[model samples]
Target: MSSPGDLPDAEVVPKKRWRIPWIWVVPAVAVLIGIWLAVQTVLEKGPTVTISFKTGEGLEAGKTKIKFKDVEIGIVKSVVLSKDYTRVVATAELTRDTANMLVDDTRFWVVRPRVAGGSVSGIGTLLSGAYIGMDIGRGKDARRDYTGLETPPVFASDVPGRQFVLRAADLGSVDVGTPIYFRRLQVGQVTAFELDKDGSGVTLHVFINSPYDRYVNADSRFWQASGLDVTLSTDGLKVNTQSLVSMLIGGLAFETPAASLSWAQAPANTTFTLFQTRSEALRVHEHIVETYVFNFTGSVRGLAVGAPVEFRGIPIGEVAAINTRFDPVTRQISIPVEVKLYPERFTSRFESGPKKGRLTNDPKALANFLVANGLRAQLRTGSLLTGQLYVALEFFPDAKKASIDWSRTPPEMPTTPSGLASLQDSINRIMTRIDKLPIEQLTASAQQTLDNTSALMQNLNTQVVPQATNTLAAARAALEAAHSTLLPGSGLQQDTTEAIRELTRTAASFRSLADYLQEHPEALLRGKPEDKK
Candidate 1:
């Protein structure tokens, strides 16, 4: 019991005591409250996630946070290198509630910065250092670690696209990230490029979006859209320079308005065949044997390995390889071009059998077909500006047939084929020859011909016409005198009347004689002495 100021006593409880001093109790209670708070924080385990990237420039282990729509979900726990050493692995921790929200497809990209397609993104993240952007999908799974995707946010909702691997000869300074356009609209991009193993070709990796991919096919032709487009006009050709971006990076466009086939959706990582536009004329057949070797022993300055080898306006093969071999005995350098041909390209239309079971690559069968149809190989000009020669297969009904022996020395190739190049050269030669022709002598001869014609016409007009006119005048005078003497009408008498009747009978006889002479010019040559009546 404890006593107040008065002597009265109050009920006394036991003096309660803490195991420790009161001063220590205050700190002990505080320690318990702190422990309880730490436990509560530990129990609320946030979502756990991971992301892979090439670099971790602005990302930090403890500082970097991952958020979804500004709501903080998780924090990056650790940064480590993957086993492959090709990527950076970032471990993250999230709240329990947010942890179940991460689905397999949930994206955790490091939102730093990016610049492309004429747009700059993620500039806000630059100031905030680097943050893990968490696109948490709805899911119901216990908290676990996830191996994030290697690629960036390639939105599936965005127009799905296909990839095209184009092999071009002269991509000349074409860089990665080049835009591929269709009718001036950017439809794709050149993602990557590398020289082929042989260094003879360049393989270009191109990606095109959804419907744009459907436009290309086996026969679609592609050309570099660079420099300026030219159009012929009355004021000469007008050149319209394209955009600077298109000129530097150099884009590619295709046009093929033929039959449309089913769209082929080539999956990612699938390899599609690439063909060079310049080498499209080259035909290769694995099963076809070497048939005829044609010798083109002439200057091949502009010829290349992939040069067009045409026959009768048809592309039969390409110049696979070219070499100059000196014939020691003849002391002449001859160019030998090895050409690869696809005999299967020539189909036998004259097959009498079923279409499906028709004979294929039969030389004799095809030769007979050609014999009846008449086939010939003429030099065709490939490029007039470049003077490139290509063989063209043609049919000439009036051309003489020439036999070819495989063992004999081949004939010299024509200087120029009947191609555009040959036509240009022929025109030039004709102009040169005309300039050197003897024009003075031709002018003299023409003048002499004109003078002779004029003289002949003058002789017929003056001498011949006057003689005929005089004969006619004299005959008329004689007729008038005879008529006056014969008809004395009222001036003469009975003798004038008798003479007039005789004169009329004589005139009728003379008219009959003139008619007979006019009908027979050749009869004049069969001359007979005139009898005096």
Candidate 2:
């Protein structure tokens, strides 16, 4: 009964309060949704981050993110020192797509102003303050660990270079950081140096451009340069240079092509040895020692250990050792010299000569043979300029022993003569003999001889020569007159001139004949025997 009326009442009660406008509520909801969405995007994607550095040296995190390039891929979160205080590690966050760039061998370094010596480098970077320099080396192998390179590097693999080692007499004052140069051009440097354990050798380590490795080899000579310039004058040469700076701060130089060396693969560690160039002072031949401890007490002013030692008149070998010793029996200073002689080896070199097959291996036979041949040791001059002397073997014409004298034969082989010492002794003996001479008596004898010669000359000139000269002049005049008539040019002046003219005419004729004969050589063989004419 009230259905129509109830519908009307319910409608009227709902229209009583329209709580809020639909338009305002809808826009407000939309604004909230948009803000929430923006915040979520920021949390997931992050902002263009910035990493602060003590010196923001090599970082381009914002502008140059870790993407291919210009792609907003990743950013450096922060730059901070490691916890242990060793290094400055940069934390970087990669975008979803940029994560692939963090592979092995991917190194990062800070690029700043570098100054070595007075030469300054990277000065252009002063304006940019500093930057994060990257060295990208792709490793075929994958890596998850993030690591860094030991040092920021210059691109060196493509440079023209090689590796080599130098054996120096001394490292001199060379240090590890020394440069290696070629003709003053910077080519390489010294990486390290080590001393030999025996305290004998120093190993110098050096490297050159790789292409130049072929030039280093076995015969290469090395010398240390101490940056000292040397010049010569009348007082000899003077040098002004610093070896220590050369070792620590200066460099070394070498040459190739002009002086090439033999090449071989050196050890991983390169090393060279130095030797003293004193070969002339050391004997390297053959001889024999009669006794282990023998003394040669003699003057040896110019004698050297390596001086040649001779036996009789033949060069047996050389003096191996000369040393001082106090003999237990004699209790005196014994200057002992050791000699070496290789009879077999010597004979091999000279056996083909006139004395072929005569050299014997038997020591006694050789000794007897030598003594019988007037063999004696003598001093000989080697070089007057150097005052170097050598022992010589001489054969005296009036030697006592004509043949093998077995009666007084030496039980042991006689030592070969050392020329230097022998010469010194000879000079000493001559000086002694001269000193012992009676000067007054010798002077008186010389004066008497001079007086006698003068008297003989006076007698020949004054007493006998005048009359003899007059008689000889008369005889010579007659002889010359007779000879003049016989010879062509010895006659009167006119006759002499005529004769000379005739001779000249004859010579001209002969020369003409010779010329004709030369032109027709067969005419000589066919000519009539001179006088058929």
Candidate 3:
């Protein structure tokens, strides 16, 4: 008010000024920033989903991360029990990148330390902590709520391969992810397996990847390659498939026949039989025309199913099975071995070479033929190391001549124990002979000799030895006295020297008398001739 009056000459305008409270200015700016950050966070959040977990063991409210193919795409915002309290529900805020990942086919699981298919995996979770693992999928419809898998799949759902079913005797050794090998190279794995429909065996579902699957054809063979295949044969010890990894993890192998004419490739879902060994898969098995039961009294410890039945060093059949039967009447146990003989094994040979006569199959004719040739069934050791025994057919002229025992259903053939049983018999005989020997008499004689020796020793020690000792002591004293006397001019030494001279003269006189008596015929009744003169 004083400014306009004071400035009389000059027209002065009041200066305009503006001021704000500095204390509240900073607070207003901070509030704007906070609002903006919240809006940005809301916009960036892709989706919210509820995941049900069997357990909430390794989860933390703000730390458990959700990953797809090992890439973190979301984080758990909260972890709590479900309404029913049956499972744990994890609420997650996913990144914008996972918008499409919330699909019907997507899978989620907890990643922790686990052992699957005989292999240890997810061991890193021991240190870094367990997190949620998600696998994305190509799904048409989107889904938010999901259930987590209890166990992880052996293979990813998107893996490219063809599945095949393999039937085997048992599935004890095999497990999921067990390797399937091709020529010892790992090319596939076991996906799943279950008992066969009939429950007689097991069926394994296997998947083989491309490029290697082509090798499996219609004529292909599959066998277990999960253990050491040591063959004890006459050729020598042959170790097959000694891979330590394959043996521990268990595995299967496939091979197509080299000389086979069929090379048809197997299609998807094709069925195949899994054999125990490669040789079993490759053997040529034919129909058995006749079944024979050999009631063997000999030991069949080393004999087993599939033991070869050889005739003249060539395999003509094989043992189908072995069992023990008790004859109540006889009160003895007998091993009944079922055998299958194929005619083709012998026919093929006769067709190719000497066709002098046809080997008849009639039971009576065959029995006569075997009897004429002295053919007998014998148990022979196939492998000494393993003690595996096989049946051998050979001529045994010295065998107890028994005619064909065709009265029984599966006519029992004339049998003999080959070298295996013979050696055992010889040992038994030697043991029996040793048992019968006169050990008692020998022991008695030895004791008598010991007693006689003891008595003689006692006599020598008590009587004869003492007398000899006294005699030795007397001779030693005499020798000492003689030495003392001979040292100087002792009278005893002189007397001894004179006595030796006189004995020498007497000996000379006797010699002369005998000489004179021999020269004279009429001496003494006849005195000596010199004395008579």
Q: Assess candidate 3 and give its TM-score to the true structure.
A: 0.57
Is 2 or 3 the stronger prediction by lDDT?
A: 3
Measured by TM-score, the strongest candidate is 3
Tens-place lDDT digits, model 2, residues 280-329: 21223224333221234554445565566554545555656666768689
Give the TM-score of each candidate.
Answer: 0.51, 0.40, 0.57
On TM-score, the stronger of 1 and 3 is 3
Candidate 3 lDDT, tens digit per residue, 333-377?
Answer: 988888887766665576566332334647568667777678888
Q: Give candidate 1's TM-score.
A: 0.51
Q: Give the poorly placed runs of model 2, Cα more than 4 Å off.
A: 1-155, 158-160, 164-170, 175-187, 192-204, 217-250, 253-324, 329-424, 430-533
Position 145, candidate 1: lDDT? 54
lDDT top scorer: 3
Ranked candidates, highest TM-score first: 3, 1, 2
